[model samples]
Target: MRKSVMTGVGVITAVVFTGGGFAAYNLWNGVTGGTRAAAAQPSTVATPAAKASAIKAPSAEAAAAGAKAFLAAWAKGDFEEAGRLTDRPEAAVAALTAFRTALTPTALTLTPTAERPQAGAPMTFRAEVGLPGAVRVWRYESAVAMVKTGDGGVVVHWDPTVVHPRLGAGKALAIRPVSSSVPSQVVDRKGRPVGAFPSIAAVLDQIEFADDGAQPAGDGTGVVVVGSAGGSGGSEPLFTISASKGAKRQLTLDADLQRVAEAVVKEQSGPASVVAVEPSTGHVLAFANNPAVGQNRAFGGATAPGSTMKVVTAAALLETGLTPDSPVPCPKNTNAGGRLVPNDFTDARLGYTFKDDFAQSCNTAFIEAAQLRLKAGSLPAVAKDVFGLGLVWKTGLSAFDTDIPVETNPEQIALAYVGQGRIRTNALAMASVSATVQSGTFRQPVLVPGKAQPMAARTLSATVLNQLRSMMQRTAQSGTAAKALGSISGAAAKTGTAEVGGQNPNSWITAYRGDLAVAVEVQAGGHGADAAAPAAAKLLQLGNSH
Candidate 1:
């Protein structure tokens, strides 16, 4: 009864090629619910399994034959004809449309492992898809679903995913940048480039893993489970179907200082990040990380700043007309807004000057100062308006700008003085804070100059700056940071330990030399004095060598 569908396709196609014959074929398709004319019918989106079983069954051999013919047509770029053969014609057309527009494919070819199901599953095949120039091919696994016809032959069962399993909603069979493009050479203050470090190179052109929107090339096509990690380096995404290297980009990174920072944090077991910027120009002198640069931790991590924030809080107190010599209290803990803010091993020296409290990193002292002396209502403005802490910076590269939310909770306000309670910052931001103090004004750091312009900020008064510098000088001389920074002449630094929901708190240190400002963080590395300060000293020494 359906012998006409199984007769030699060449002869059948010739007979069906006439105008009247074509219209009759379309009508029969509509009447019998065949897929070839689905586009002319109503649109329906079905899942893979639903699509596979939509059409009635024919003969097993006929289905295999139909699969072979479908692959052959699709391989030769007869997308319209091949789409007409599927249960959902619109889906196949949509896939073809994406391939043409987005993939920018020049040529494509499909080949089946078996002409008929001799042993394994039927319709398993490979698709060699070419990019713009047809110079490279992304060999993709593809197949066609075959269903039995009511009479005796088989029709191709079709789903758009037959092109690529990840081609559904929210996913696409696309071409994207695995590694970002780099322009010329990024340089330091003196025009010296940090030599090609694998870590730095990786950062310049980020190598996105396979979890991104890239499909595997040349993975097992037939007999492979859907969504399983494919081939070798399963998590590795194919950069592009073709390769086109871009111009070498330049950066404002210092090679020598970067090496010193990398060497210090390279041996650490867990994640660590360090950044060094020039105080006068706000140029990024050096950047290093233990996990090797894919995650730009130095410029854009939203980690809690911990006690290192005291430097900014101190600025607020100084602006409130409180002198460094003003007397203040140091207690173990202060409970406000039903929350307790405690110092690191807080040893209460009931009466201490503001200078002594900052040097010792007394948490409660600064908390009290934030509310009582500085006027809690004006706390947030100190960092944002005065020092440019929370303002949006126009850094050339991607950066996590500081987020210092205004605090209404007394406990939270106290926590804010100590770098907690909704206050978040990145290494670049903290380094800028130190730089602002050292330079007496804010200068936003930049990777590529002129690309990111800096915003003007309110500067500290000369007297206030002198006193702040004096306080930090005392810190390096005999306070919490003294042990690590004692050897470096003129070194002034502050240390912090931020609680990050774990057994150990994250360690941090922001330091400055004559013209250099550096910030470092060690995730879950305990006390800042023990983990972050030593690394800071080493980097400061290297930058000073210039």
Candidate 2:
């Protein structure tokens, strides 16, 4: 692998592990020279020491040479060198970084599945890599893709998953989240019990009073908590609630919808989240974090929301003199506050309306409109007063506190229109925005009873509301989200791709149909149309079916 690679042949080898002990390693003669076990090898007869080895296909010879070179580099614990043999060495290097050490397979053997291996055929191999901080070997089935080099040698067509299946830019394969022991219930809007959601489980609490008999003692107010640690599941107490006084909270989650969402999210490979609500009322019908990984990211995450925030910006634009059909400039890029903002793929200057820019997700059009049509400090009002952002929402269980701060920086203001810079929100908040648009009024979201109603923000005028809905509908029918969300009747949607530095931008989709509104996010997912929108479409289909 460190060399410029081989040509003309390929070989498939099964790396039979000797379990990485000092004794076994010396016997195998290290990486390439010897692979047979002394016990497994048959005694060789002196007579007729076999003429020449049979001729190998050029592709097979090249593959075998390539595999051996990679194995040798790996044996020296030179993963960096071995990485170079693969097509995607960058991804390979990233995945290999987790091991923090170059490792050799203690034993190796050639087990050719095909007589003469050809380029691009996968070679199955078993390797017990010497992972750092552990004596016991880790065993797994891994395959490498072989491609023909220009000189006729084969090189691995690498995927990061080859190092470890879950290893990617943002993911580390070796570490994972612990399963929750405590349980909590998520119910639908009408107070029907749903399943136990991980988000609710992460912040759930159970209280138990030591002494149960004494008149439930002082109105159950000052009981000492004992033997408790809380995080996910149903909020049922180990002891009786009348005695222990534990809280049994119900969430606005529909069981059927949650199951459907979970099923759809599982079919996808990356991390994702879905927040669905009953639009007429801000009641969550289903909330699911993809694979239920990490923290409760669905309810508590704060991401830029890509173009989805255009919903908020458009609302602000209508408040100004501009109508949906108002002419707007969406050149390739526009300057605002001395900072340039580019439309990702829009050309509104070729004669397009504000509504056209919106459906097409024109970034510069909104930035120009924001500077020319609206005054400074207007977005904070747009977010807080109209969209019900900035309020400390008490959604029964623990939840994300949404923030959309006003920006004085010209570039910040320009980017905010496209949901970059400082505009951060969770799926719950975005779903609420869609619900407000769907219902023509802002409904304060409540996960449990006793949620305080924040002061009423300025309501959207009837004309503005009609136009907003129409624009969203237009987006679903012919815009970016159309490929994913167009089939459903009476559907309206907005897709977003929030840019995160270095890695891929977060994918976002906020949509509403009839009384149901749903928001979805895919972390490090490339774009709204390619990544987030499909997840949203699946959830919507299942939500409607249920």
Candidate 3:
């Protein structure tokens, strides 16, 4: 008898005797080549049809179960066990080991397709592979080819395609640093470069990936998977990866307004900041800081607001039955909790109205009004209840909201009334202050579109709203703000020069025109009319175009 070798896993070799053209059947293990069974009579040779019946094929269910077991083992990092479930154990082990070492995957999930496998067919599955700090999970579909074994069991048919559908023969998977050809970037609402406004660097740093799945720009040091494609033996990128640094994130800031604000603040020799907002929606148009690299004082610093605090003080007085025409005394110096408070200019007039006090920023008038008419907690109550100040403001980023603590000390209350002693605010807060007056309601400021915060429950009465607008208009028309904003029709503003224990005081101005509101602060930049008002005017001047 002569025997031919059938060299394969679980393959059997058949023995043929050349007598009478008949073949004797013998079952021998392909690996061991040991005889298993001899034909009983060694009769005629078996036909091709009969020989095919001798080998039993696995059922479709058996193939699916075997594929599932192999995937489970791979997902669990059990390369050895996974290899044992495959037809070629050594090759499977080597390839799987290489995949793990090269990819360093943090997570892996394999989901079988809804359709079950047919006999001797590939079992399709969805693969979601994850890497550490990757911008997103890499998703693809692959299949598990199954084969029947000699032991009446099914095993995975090993092929490079099982790991990745694109991984052909002689190809290996590897992760390399992402090429700088595609780096993450951000843009303003008008598609301008976000980095152009150096003052908003802090705001940009707080944002991450964009929701839209657009491709990233420029190259980066991020992670990526590179490999050979279609058995070409040439290196090519299979996947680009990165941390959640978005390719392109869009901000709510208007690029035109940002340019104007940056240019305005740049005119200051000392530290300066400005914030602009849309009164109708409370959307932040622009926020800029001079020198561009220091702390985000435009949105976070809580310095005293000087006479700008009178806006809230006036609201408190209006809430307590005082009208804009109500008589108020603005003496050269008045007693406030035994401390002498003086106005910017001595008022010798006998009967000045509440409108005069606000327009002229009379420190004595507001101090005496709060001391005589308002209760101990009235100022903070009004700030929180009506103006939305002193409340948690979710502006989609880090910001210091207004802080007006309830004061029982009459001395502190007197100072706080004129925006001095414990009244702390920033340009963002004061800009919203003007926005509330213009909108007749408190709309929380938002820098990101679709991130608007809940509005305050209380709204300003129409009477109080009209009075505040009229008083601010008068100030812009003839008072401290006239030189900077009076020429612009319908413009309204309030100017302040806050005492910060220095020869040069902090300049502050809050203004609104049409649907826009803005505030400016210049540290040690002299009076508000000279320093902050011009910056605020420029911000409003550009709003007409937007």
Top of the candidates by TM-score? 1
lDDT of 3 by residue, 1-546 (tens): 111111111112232223222222333222222232321111122222222221455788787777777766665445556667776666666565555445545556666773458786788876666655554555678898877766666778777778777666545566554453323555776777665467865445454333355665545433232333422334445565552355666666788888899899899998999999888888888889887765788888889998888888898898788988999978898877778888777655448899988888888888887777889898888888877888888776678878898877778888998888888889999999999999898888887667747767688789888988999999999989999998988999899889987658999999999999999999998888989998898877777345
Stretches of candidate 1 off by over 4 Å are 1-180, 184-195, 206-248, 544-546
lDDT over C-alpha atoms for residue 403 of model 3: 88
| Number of backbone collisions per candidate | 19, 25, 10
RMSD of each candidate relative to the true structure? 15.7, 16.1, 22.2
Q: What TM-score would candidate 1 get against the native?
A: 0.63
Whole-model Cα lDDT per candidate? 0.65, 0.61, 0.73
Off by over 4 Å in 2: 1-193, 196-249, 346-349, 543-546
> In terms of TM-score, which candidate is stronger, 1 or 3?
1
Q: Please provide, for model 1 over 363-426, each residue's C-alpha lDDT reduced to its tens digit, 9 standing for 90 to 100.
A: 8888877777765656578788766877777666678888887767677777778887778887
Local distance difference test, candidate 3: 0.73
Residue 92 alpha-carbon offset, candidate 1, angstroms: 17
**Alpha-carbon error at 207 in model 2, in Å?**
12
lDDT of 2 by residue, 109-193 (tens): 3222333346545565444443222223333455555666544445666654454333333322221122222223334545565
Position 405, candidate 2: lDDT: 74
**Top candidate when judged by lDDT against the true structure:** 3
